[model samples]
Target: MNPRITDHPAVPYERTRRVAFTFEGRTLHGYEGEPVATALHAAGVRVLSRSFKYHRPRGIGLTCGAPSCPNCQLTIDGQYGVPGCATPLRGGESVRRERAWPSADHDLFGVIDRFSPFIRAGFQFRLFRRSPRLAHLAERVMGLIAGGGREVTPDAIARAARPGLGERRTALAVVGAGVAGLAGALAAADAGLEVVLVDQGAEPGGALRAETAPVRTPDGGAAPGFALAAELAARAAAHPAIEVLTGSTALGWYEGGVLPVHTPSGVLTLRPARLLVATGDYDQPLLFPGNDRPGVMVAGAVQRLVNIDHVRPGSRAVVVTRDAYGYAVAAQLCAVGVEIAALVDPRPGERAGADAEASFPSGVAASGVPHLTGHRLREALGRRTVTGVVVEPQEGVDGRGRAVRLDCDVVVVSAGRRPAEELLLQRLYHGDITLDPGPGTALPDGVAVAGGAAGITDPAEALTTGADAGARLARWSPENPALPEISPYPLSPGQAGRPSSSGGTSE
Candidate 1:
């Protein structure tokens, strides 16, 4: 049986309220609120979907829920495409794998992998086309092969699309309800500006929902971690001026701050005077052989599975990381009753020795769990799910060191994070702003960014930056006579832009 977490005394719902769902005509049971992808993983059902052409095996890579990777794309409720990791499993929900014939587990189209060399790019057309009639036939054949799911014709799209509701106007709109988005909303409301906060999750607080432990506060005191995410989420929900929309996703932005937000009920057109994109970050995966296995997961997803969903990822775990974030993950795994085989540090000996134990909590530190410094994960060994990790010393002689294999069912990787800047990038593309904004420039008016989305990882820094942005927007003036001018979100390492010159003063 898959290792399930049912030992947390603080959270009772972790073990109860099982909800059943159907996938590919097979009935499966999962928790009431957990993602369908997590439930599928717990049932050992990997390879959710196949690639368009080659049909290579795709398993959960990051489990990011953002669906940054195509590993977990599947059809839900007659929809031909959806991110299974991000899509929640409702009782009796029907899910099916897309782009795979017969089944995702045993796809007949997988034979295309053998002929991938002949089908590289448009080589097949050149190879098969002879005369005008033959070329037309070859084009038809290629189209049939390339199309994975049902044709998405204009008529089909119209049938599937939901009707748009009327528009709503707000003083300020925040795209995400994560750390930065929540902070921005609360600050803007506290500063007397009407605000609207939108998030994709069923609830607000973003990553804060997964953070259970206390973190160091700004003043060096202990705070309910995530800079009090629970407290902030509660306050935002109850704030008079702040309108919170859970399970709402900001689709896109247009000129004049016209935003199309996708809600479960329908589309909401938001004409906010100001917009803030604080969507936060997605976890980066480690690069190694067998990294795409079923049991391999990103550190953030593992935390969410344990703390938020109350699911144990595995019985034995190996954490491989380059930073202090990995230590925290190991501690969490240990607390959830998962055996931490070892903590592998890939940094050089000097840096690893100095900081390997810095982030470890007392429970993990005092347990005498083996800490392997300066060791790089050479490969993950297993046919399907992860079974063990082979590690070697980074500074060993002649690039060949004694390899140590740590047996573990799960491998949690915490390398770093990349900014979730898709929305920001899309908005920037519409304006005449160049991709490379010069260093230290102010930003365009009516737009602001904060938190992890702005590359600020420290929770304290994210909270402060978000509050600053909200406060500045509240006191915005044509001629800034009071507050020192705040810099824009960093375009590059040091590059920034001025606020939009045409932004009207706040009412």
Candidate 2:
């Protein structure tokens, strides 16, 4: 079934020019500028790769926009291990599944999952310990099975041999193009400082580009978050002192303010007097059996697919959340004509108190979707893909509760988020950085952080912090030191039960 969404209210879908690409020797069509993963997903190709050891089927789970997961890594255009989620679809690109024997859909090695118990960690060394010849053969076979991608093509080798490193300097460099980064860039530009704003996304809005709900503006009006992002992006583009670079990945920060950034064109060495890191956060996946199944996905990934890529994740979904963010995601799904089988919140208390109910979108309650409070996800049900889910009430809440089965093709998770602060942490401290440190705590000289990187998830707070950081790095003090006038949506009272301040994690 075609899962492309054409009737989203918040972000209207427009027919764009289509590009034809070859995947596994078969030609497929997708819109230009969309990611290869979404293209494949829209074309009904779910299984992207196989797990390293168990050879279990895997899809583009957490690799939606963030390249943190390896599930969607494919051999693209004869290059090995390219992230399909981040690579935009250009016409005529050759894509192939990696790490799967025969094909991702019908892998012969899938039987390894049935004997996973025998293949425990470091079992390879002991499995054929007695026979040296058997152990050597097993080692070679395992190496071939684990290796992904084919030999590098001659074209790829030629391109790699070309020297294309560039260098530039700026007064201030902001390392994200979200609301916070935009605000920071604008603030720095207003202070007459030359600024460079870099982001890895195809667009400049960051996660705001994925929001389908309308947010309250500063002037008592309401606008969609994507619209607000567009406005900020336009202003940044028009600003004389701000240079906005999209589709650019900031590799890392080195000694003496040296930063190497990778772009579609070439690598650029950037040296800035001061830096502001607003890289934001990643959606933390939940811990459960079958959570890594093909049809299960993080809430942020689903939002990005629906609102940004205009693709429906599935026909029916089971939403498992720990905070109000999940309900918002459910509302967006409902708005786009996806069925919500159930909304499960594992926290104890009455089934969504009055305050929590108020936080939910009116459509959610009006549609009569089931709400299971104090219910935890026991396991996601399905083997190759998610066919349903099993949920049970939290222990010690009341008398023993029986597990309830909810049939769904998709499972949306919004457990919580962990800060994406790799760049900042590398620059400041060698030790582990705290996930939820107070804003602006223990930051080193000539460096600042804002937004989720600084542990501020609220949009309003992120904007304010970003503006402050930009102004501070420029050493400009306005007469009126007040928060910026951009008022985005704030977390509701229902969010009080969000994951602990330490942040959420994946198993």
Best by lDDT: 2
After superposition on all CA atoms, how large is the RMSD of candidate 2? 5.4
Cα lDDT computed for each candidate against the true fold? 0.71, 0.76
**Residue 444 lDDT in candidate 1:** 56
RMSD list, candidates in order:
5.9, 5.4
Ten contiguous residues minimizing lDDT sum, candidate 1: 498-507
TM-scores for every predicted model:
0.85, 0.88
Q: Would you give me the overall lDDT of model 2?
A: 0.76
Kindly give the stretch of ten consecutive residues in candidate 2 with the minimal lDDT sum. 487-496
Those runs of model 1 whose alpha carbons end farther than 4 Å from true positions after fitting are 9-16, 61-67, 111-147, 151-160, 218-220, 353-355, 362-368, 395-400, 435-437, 440-442, 477-484, 493-507
Cα deviation of 81 in candidate 2 (Å)? 1.0
User: What is the C-alpha local distance difference test score of candidate 1?
Assistant: 0.71
